[model samples]
Target: MLQMAGIAVAGSCLSPTYASKSRLLVSIPAQLHREFTPPLPAFISLNQRRREVLPSKSLQTALIRCFDTNKAASAESEENAKPNKVYFARDAIVDAAARIAPAVANLYARKGGQEEEGEMGSGTVIHEDGYILTCSHLFFNKMDVTYAADEEIIVCTQDKEIGHVVDAYVDLDIAIIKIDSPSSPLSTAKVGSSSKLRPGDWAVAMGSPLSLQHTVTLGIISCVHRKSYELRREGMAMEFLQTDCAINPGNSGGPLCNVDGELVGVNVETMKAHKASGVSFAVPVDLISAIIKPFQSCQMPVQPYFGWVMRNVRKENLEALKQYYPTFPNALEGVFVQKVIKGSPADRAGIQAGDVVVDFDLQQIRNIKEMMDVMVKRSGTPVDVIVERLMLGKNRLVHLTITFEEKDVAAPRPRL
Candidate 1:
């Protein structure tokens, strides 16, 4: 017997006969049971009355089983929801350099048949038949003078070969040299688009820095469309793609490649002398593509002569111009014409020194570099230009028609 709530309960409730079924039994004193008993509703059945008076073992067991099942399902769900492990390869730069390595070669230029010392630089093979592209300044002296026609340029690849300057564009500082055909087909770099490049993209420069051949340096692009004037390199109308890759003297004319091993630019200049690290410049592949055909055909690329010295409108320059003109537009956004050559296209079109070129050939002109690029494509064609000129202390828009004239650029004699 067991004592519960001042009532004696029979321990036989745990017996096999009662435990085998879903029933429980309890024994209580007669006086207490009658005192605690309450009247049941008429709708309650006999079994319901029994259930209200005694606990049901089947109901308790069912509740415990349901809770255990829910807990186990939740644990399994959490285990399956965990993320999976991933893997990555970190040899992208190494792979990229290896892809374009075969096309890169070391170039040595000798003048007057002197084998003691000569100009040394790097070059990229652009054609499988042995045409190499390099910087024109590589063959020039400190005075910015070209070498004699009889100078010898030796190309060192897997094997030594004689090279000759086929053609050169001095203004852009680009030269193409052709080497004697090798016994096997030469590897050419896969050319990529420079116009698609953006700042912060991976830039890999492969060249010979300080006579170190087949050297590769890695960095990121710093700027695209860097104008020549911004670098204080006047008379060059083209723009450069600036990178933070380490480029040295011998690195000039080497290939600037992307992560996919495609050539995007030709390495040209670096700011190592200024004690700056990772500051370099390259000629954009678009400009290289533009001159490749002409160079191969033994013709010099024609430049359009607009015959005007211009500057991009900037806050500092505009402020300075306002002090003199007093009527210059304060919010002007265009290329400012500083001087117009006499009898030139701009002069004949009524463009004056103080005019701001707002539009050209139906396209808006924002900077001098952009204007130059457009002029190059539309050379030898008639186009309309809109300028903002101050008239009676007020800004007036004037539209004029002008035809671009092709400037005569002499091509170097090709030695086949």
Candidate 2:
């Protein structure tokens, strides 16, 4: 027997002996309609019956089992219901931005007791003792004298504080400023590993864009290994983490964070012509960490110098080169040495112009970027380089070992 919404059902094929027993009182909720009701058994019949019905004990037990199953199913469906993906992503971005907001600071370059509008920039506090990291170019004047003789760097945290330029690496365009926050420890951002990053990962940029403090922008990692030379920034041997996050002039030196609010890169420059195209670049935190580690001991990091101009091997460029040297190698991939500085490491190693670099430090060199990446890591060490050259009207592989000379940007000074 089954009952639902004032309707009673009973099995018609029940034995006469069981039907002669006392009627079973089965009751169901009056509000339950066909939509909420479960399917009835095939042997049951729905008809206008009294409030009580006669049914076998086995049939009564089956009806109770069906109701229990439906109840459990409805509960599971409600439990599985979840919010949209957009809401989850929104919360992630909000939490990430809030985590790093306290460590970001606005920087101002003041000259003649007035703050220069164009000299505004951003920085991230990397130490609890008020050590801020920012771009060195922010303090450069037309004459490029670090900071002008009369200009001062004013760091604005929760309150205004005078900042002193403790160290500056012009080659990498990184600067370290110190502020005296002895009364309280400043908030510092947690650094993350940029080498583990991949394309399409979430990126968050926090800084003061257009002098608006605490600005945050959400974007994805456009690329992980964008070479500096590819962006027309010559002589820089580092690669950047390219992102679509909006980084304006004032956003430079700010922290570029991941979805978990860890600092992965330092916001650097954006394509001026493509400002609306969402093309921006950040210096990978790995390189920044290497450069700043020596600063803690009041020492400057070593800058590796490789005096050679090179480019990737393209068909058009190779054809142009073959016009001059008809015996140039017709290789599909290799770094083409265009010019070697006189008396430099390449020149000293017998590497001449028109040479195609095949391998360096036991690693194949496919482009100038790869060569630069390897050279930066193996600084102040001797490495074997293999190049293909036309010798006596025949292609010959020449092996040479070159040692890189590391130079310091400035002398170490006592900490401020």
Reference-based lDDT, residue 185, model 1? 60
lDDT tens per residue, model 1, 1-416: 22463332353443657544634444345545766766443222245324323112213322322222223234455344433333224798989999889989888776666543533788888766677888867754312221333466778777877776654544466667777456566787878889999999899998888778899999999999898888877443578999999888889989999988888998988975667777799999887564443223323233233445455565545666666555466445787665555555566678887888889888887765566466556545677999898888778989998864343534332342
Per residue, candidate 2 scores C-alpha lDDT tens digits across 1-416 of 22532333243124445434644333333334533766444333233342222223224332322222223234454345342333245489999998899889899877677777754889998766677888766753312312232246678777787665554444456666767333466787877889989999999999888899889999999999998888877443678999999888799989999999998998988988543479999988887664444323322232222345455565545565677656567676787665555545566678887788899899998765566567566644677999988888878889998764333323222122
Evaluate all candidate structures by whole-model CA lDDT and list the values in order: 0.68, 0.68
| Colliding residue pairs in candidate 2 | none
Off by over 4 Å in 1: 1-88, 114-119, 141-149, 293-416
Name the Cα RMSD for model 1.
Answer: 17.9
Best candidate according to TM-score? 1
